[model samples]
Target: MADVVNSRSRSSSPSSLGATEFKFPEGLVAHRENLPAGRVTATTLDGTLTKAPLQLIEDLSNGCGGQLWPAGIRLAKYFISRYRNGDELTGKRVIELGSGGGVTGLAIGLELDQIGGDIDEGGCEFWMTDMQAMMELMEKNVSFNGLQERIRCGLLDWADPLPEFVARRPVDIVLAADCVYFEPAFPLLEKTLCDIAGPDTEVLFCFKKRRRADMRFIKSIRKRFVMTEIKDEIYARESIYL
Candidate 1:
């Protein structure tokens, strides 16, 4: 089986922010690594005026998924470039797994809202989930962007059972970025994916290769699901490989 690998071209330093709160550096500076607690403003998708200024508190003092990673940015771009308006997302149940800072899901919510509609009339609903520790920042991001009604934030630890609210219905799309590190969590992640994903469900993962151990994580999931890479012409030349 082909190992799942997705990459995006990296950019410059993009002007570092102080250890406290900071907004995302403006312009084409898309990638920022290990920023301490800060607020970041980024486009919801590509070639669109919609912007989501997310308030993120990254406590490096915390363990994995604390800071925003580059793959999240790339995945946001992919959503913007691909799912314009709510056409693709309309009537679908969307969820972002391991949603650090809630950027990807928030972006989608913004786009869906902009496209405009009530849930009964083809509008989509979103769920942003992570460990309990990340709830504050996730909720802050959801509220920061005025998406409370459209997006719901929840505690979703991979090792635990899926919340009743989440498993009550089928999920159409699962968005995950920079979530496949830490060797010990591999089985937990795989089991969670299997539990949530149906045969027809689509899971879009955006991540740069980090270590050889990542392959082990991918190998574990391949037994249950087929993984594929999507190449976007808009970001093809700009993508940086891990």
Candidate 2:
């Protein structure tokens, strides 16, 4: 999946943004006779933890949200790395926006379980949300991984009002990955962020830059939230070792 995305990022441009053209390669069946369940394994946390084999049903027949994208993979791993032993996330209320496959939210639960934390008792209260289009597959993944107790799924169009369950309490964190695609959604997403997150809510947004237009989304959000780039450690030697 990462290879396919890297190839697209290298080949595509704003004028020829084939974001919706992404699909499984011809004859490369995701499901075979041996694995008749039509599911695939995505090793999160660098293979330290494996999510239950997710049912691979990429309904690109409708839209691109059904497939797992690379940015979501990166964000999921980042959450796993940041929340080890559940120190910072023990009881915080978290909400993952554009949670296509619930990877990041599931990774948080898996990480809690990895470090001897009880997801049913000590895990962070988390909600994974996306537009109505992606609800079925997203909900299936949550149940497939046995995360019903730790995470909830809902329909969350950024332009619409916040769901009643989420608005009941102050959100502590907002997680989004690869959500900046269409230009029209920029303001809607920005508004949703401001509405859901309070002054203290931590927003972890991750996206691979596919076009200069992607900058527009950043510009709109900057007015409401102070932004900082998290540089890779290997490339930040001067800043780290200085």
Candidate 3:
């Protein structure tokens, strides 16, 4: 998988991205493979977000997104490193596309909570979106984090028009993780990303390349948006590969 933050796509130097403290069942090796099927419950982004860890439940009954993936962890940590105290996201409209278990967005809420008072008052609105099938798991995780009041979960099919909640205002930041896996859905993802991301919007896209076709999805969007790969500071980029 890869981590790309699209802000008009410049192929400059790989920016340094620090890692966060996390507790995984199988450590970093989990990303090289998929977890055994059934259900998984664990706390991720353990130390950084809050005193109580961000707990998540992974149920693959709906789709692969039901489980946590490398890009989600990387993107969440990268976001935390940059906006750990939650000041940058203040007043920004952030949305995570294809948020299977709402891991990334929920982790974000934990940071935004650092601002104190109601997160809504901070003018920072967060929406974790995915297909209808993933809503239950998403909502469950939101409740897991005690973030019901901080986040909103919605149905956002990439092939469909922007949901009313997202269409109502300008989306300042877009967080997408592991969205490039299925080649058949490339056009749909492209349309939706380009549709929602304005000239000034920031898009954080992270994915692990399961196949060469995933690069095709990347190329399709390069024409419209520049993709800059994030350089991981803790481990070599190759470490993410199996």
Candidate 4:
């Protein structure tokens, strides 16, 4: 909802020396590249909660969905921060939409296994879904993190009907990041969310504010869902980014 960020300058007091260095959100690390295709390796993710580093191979030849994004990193870190409580993602069915690099989904699966959380049937069921073009990248990342058994990479088109993998079972949570960049895909994304997100479903979506059209997508989602802003240090600092 924040498109314009106010720029204010004020004198800092002599005692305002407690400011800390800015860093990416906790439980989040990404190695990106400018090349058309490359590998990304992140070794540390907020300590013991992460047993191993996550590696994602991005192939831009496929599409924009081949690279990582800030929203996905933030979502992964935020969700891991919350899941460490041991109650989250327990036997829950989670689907991440528009998973470009599959960072968020891969990280969740990694952390769940690191902490010995349930990932088998009757446990947390996680699926990383995107358009057909992103299926290969999604699968590679899942295998890179040794989570092939834990995470399922599915082809999900926003404009198409609900896939059997999704329609067969009710989704408990829907995770999306950087899914609002394309103007033409707005209605398709909206339709998918409405179809999958029942009254009991929870959607934790994060996106960078880029244009006026982004606000329109938010407004449309609000018409069907009770959307709320999650106040945090990361959300506050990143909200102003264009």
User: TM-scores, in order shown?
Assistant: 0.75, 0.73, 0.79, 0.80
The best-first sequence of candidates by lDDT reads 4, 3, 1, 2
lDDT per residue as tens, model 3, 1-242 = 22211121122111221223334332342352444443334443545555445555566777778777777776787887788653776777888899998768877777655422334577577889999999988987787667878788889999889989899888888999878878889999999998899988989987766688877877888889877767764433433321
Backbone N/Cα/C clashes per model: 5, 0, 5, 1
lDDT of each residue in 1-107, candidate 2, tens digit only: 22221112221122232333233431232222233122333343345355432223334333456555556656776777676553677657788899875656666
List the candidate 3 regions with Cα displacement exceeding 4 Å. 1-40, 114-121, 233-242
lDDT of 4 by residue, 59-115 (tens): 677877776566776678778877776566667788889998787787777876532
| Clash total of candidate 3 | 5
Best by lDDT: 4
What TM-score does model 2 achieve against the real structure?
0.73
Q: List the residue pairs that clash in candidate 1.
A: 8-239, 8-240, 9-238, 9-239, 9-240
lDDT of 1 by residue, 61-146 (tens): 44456555667666765776678743777777777889877656766666545333445688776778999888886776666667
Which sections of candidate 1 miss by over 4 Å? 1-57, 114-119, 232-242
Cα error, candidate 4, residue 225 (Å):
0.1
lDDT of each: 0.64, 0.62, 0.69, 0.70
Model 1, global lDDT: 0.64
Give me the candidate number with maximum TM-score. 4
* Candidate number with the higher TM-score (1 or 4): 4
True-structure Cα RMSD, model 3:
10.2
Model 4 ranges off by over 4 Å: 1-34, 43-49, 114-121, 240-242
